[model samples]
Target: MAKTIFITGASRGFGKLWAAAFLEKGHKVVATARDLRSLDDLVNKYGTNILPLQLDVNDRAADFAAIAQAKQHFGSIDVLINNAGYGLFGSIEETTEQQAREQMETNFFGLLWLTQAVLPVMRAQGHGHIIQLSSVLGLVTVPILGLYNASKFAVEGLSESLAQEVKAFGINVTLVEPNQFATDWGSASAAVTTPMPEYDGARAWLQAAASEDKIGIPEATVPAILQLIDSENPPLRLLLGKQGHPWTRQVYEGRFAEWDAWQEIAAAAHGK
Candidate 1:
C-alpha cells in the first residue's frame, strides 16, 4: 500500500535517499531540511508527490508547525523518519558544553518533540511507524565521537521505551543503527572541536581512518527501512550494515562477560 511518509533532514545523505526511494515507489513524501532551497532538486524530480519544507529540528516551534502542516497537507502521516541529526566529532573532554547541548538538542530532544507532535495523529488513526536513524555508536563507544555517541545512545534508549509505550496505540518505533556508510556525513554534517595536544595521536588516527573510503553502502539501508515500515511486527531496534551486527554483538558479549566476572562484587553492594 502506498503511504504518506514524513522525513527530516531530507536534503542529503540517508534522508534524501529514503525520500527518493519512497517517491519512486509512488508513495507520498513530506520531506524537510534546514533550508527549503536545498530540497529544490527533490521537488523538481518528484513533483507533487514530495512536499519540501524548511525545518530545523532543534526549533520546537518550527518542528510542531511543520508536523501540523504536514498532517494538514497529507491528511495523515503513516510513517515518520527522524533523520535530522549531525555528528559532533571530538573527545568528551575536548567538546564544549554548548556543542554537547546542541548535539543533544538535535539528536535526542528534537526526535522526542517531533514524536510527541505526531503521536496524537497516529493515535487517532490507530497505526503509524516511527523510524529513528541511530548509529552503531549508540551501542558502543569510540574515540573522537563521544558527544555523537552519547546523543545516539540516548536515542536508542528513548526509542526502546517509546516503542513499548506506543504499542497499544498501534504506533511502532524502530531505531536504525548503521555503521559507517559512504555518505558526506563525516565531512559535510560533522562539527569538529579545537584540537588538544594530549589527544593529537588519537585525533590523527581518527582523521586517517575517516579519510579511508567507507565500506557500507547508503542505498543498501533503504530496503531494510522500507521493510520495517511495511512490517506488522517490526523490531524495536534494527541494526543495519554487515559491520553493525557483529560489532554490536561483540559489545553486548563483552558487557555480559564483564557483568559475569563482577557478579559477586556487584551483588555484595546490596548487603544481601
Candidate 2:
C-alpha cells in the first residue's frame, strides 16, 4: 500500500536515499532538510510525489510547523523517519558543555518534539509508525564518539518507552542501530572537537582503523526499514548490518556475564 512518509535530513546521505526509495515504491514522501535548495535533485526526480521543505530539527517551533505542513499536504502521515541527527566526535572530557547540549538538542530533543507533534495526528487516525535513526554505538561505547553515543543511547531508551506507551494507539516505534555506512555521515554530518594529547593514542588508533574503504553500502539499510514498516508486529529495536549484530551481542553478553558473576552480591543488597 502506498502511504505518506515524512523524512527529515532528506538533502543527503541515508535520508535522501530513503526518500528516493519510498517515492520509487509509489509512496508520498515529505522530504525535509535545513536548506530546501539542497533537495533540488529529489524534487526534480520525484516531482509531485516529493514535498521538499526547509526544516532545522533544532528549532522546536519549526518542527511542529513542518510536521503540520506535511500532514496538511499529505492529508496524513503514515510513517515518520526521524533522520535529522548528526554525529559529535569527542571523548566526554574533550566535548564541551555546549557541544553536548547541541548534540542532544538535535539528536534527542528534536526527535522528541517531532514525535510529539505527530502523535496526535496518528492517534486520531489510530495508526502510524515512527522510525528513529540510532547507531550501534547506542548499545556499545567507543573512544571518540562519547557524545554521539550518549545521544543515541537516549534515543534507544526513549524509543523503547514510546513503543510501549503507543502500542494501544496502534503506533509503532523502531530504533535502527546501523553500523558504519558509505555516507558523508563521518565527514559532512559529524562535528569534530579539538584534539587533546591525553587521548591521542586511542583516538588515533580508532581513526586509523576506521577506513573509508570499510564502509558498507548505504542502500543496505532500506530493505530492513521497509520490512519493519510492513511488519504486523515490528520489533522495538532493529540492529542493521552484520557488524552491528555481532558487536551488540558481544557487548550484551559481556555485561550479562559480569552481572551473573556478581549475582550473590547484587541479590544480598535487595533483602536481609
Candidate 3:
C-alpha cells in the first residue's frame, strides 16, 4: 500500500531525508517546516506527490490547520512523523526558565498537539501510524542536555501510551531513538547559556563535547525509519545506531532493576 505521510520539520536534516525516502518509495508526503523556502527543490523534484507546507509545529492553531489542509489535499494521512524537534544543550542552572519552556513547547507539546489533531481522522478511517523522533538522551539523561532529555522523555511516555490506547483503533506508534546523527540539528540548535562561575574550569570539557557531537552524520537513521514504516510488526521503540542500542538497553534494564529492588519498600509505603 502506498502510505500518505505527513512529516514535520522536513526542510532539512533527518526530516528532509525521511520525506525524500518516502517519496522515493512512491508514497505521497506532506512535508512541513517553519519555512518552506528550502523545500522548493524537494517539491520540484517530487512534484504533485510532495506538498511543502509551512508550519510552526509549536503553534497549536497552525499545526491543526496544516494537518487539516494536508488531509483535504491527500484525502487521508496514513502516517504522521513528529520530527520537528531541536537540541537544547545547557546546564540546568545556566538554562533560563523561558528557554526551557520554549524547548518543551516545540519538542514536546508540538508533537502532542499534532498527534491530537490527526488522531480523529485516523480513528475514523481505522488505520494510521505515528512516528516520534526521540533521542537516546530520552532514555539516558546527560550533562548540559537536560531540557532536551526531558522533552524527549515526555515524547517516549506519550508514544508508549498512545501505542496501547490506539491499538484497538488500528493506530500504531513508533518511537525512534537515534544516537548522534549527522544533522545541523545539533550545532544549529545548540543552546549556549551564561557560563556559571562555579564551572569555569570545565568550559573546555563542554566545548570539546559539543565539537565531537557536531561531527555525527545522519544517513543511517532514515533507513531505519523507513524500515519501521514498512515493517509488518514494527517495534514500539526502534533504537538507531550501534552505539545507541547497547546504551539504551543498559539504561532501560538498569532502571527496571532498580525499580524491582525497591518494589517491596515502595509497595509498603503506598499500602500495596
Candidate that would win on TM-score: 2
RMSD per candidate (Å) reads 1.4, 1.3, 2.3
Per residue, candidate 1 scores C-alpha lDDT tens digits across 1-272 of 99999999998999999899999889999999978888888788889899999888988988899899999998999999999999998888898889999999999999988999899999999999999999989999878998999999899999989999999999989889888888888888889899788998888887776544546888988888778888988888888887878777888999999999999999999997
Task: Please give the lDDT score at residue 182 for candidate 2.
Answer: 85
Q: In terms of TM-score, how similar is model 2 to the real structure?
A: 0.96
lDDT (C-alpha, whole model) for all candidates: 0.89, 0.89, 0.86
Backbone clashes for every candidate come to: 0, 0, 3
Off by over 4 Å in 3: 200-216, 256-264, 270-272
For candidate 2, give the lDDT of residue 16.
89
Error of 3 at 159 (Å): 1.5
Candidate 3 lDDT by residue in tens digits, 87-172: 88677888899999999999999999999999998999898989998988888876777889999999999989999999999888
Task: Give me the displacement of residue 45 in model 3, in angstroms.
Answer: 0.9
Q: 2 or 3: which has the higher TM-score? A: 2
What TM-score, computed on C-alpha atoms, does each candidate reach? 0.96, 0.96, 0.91
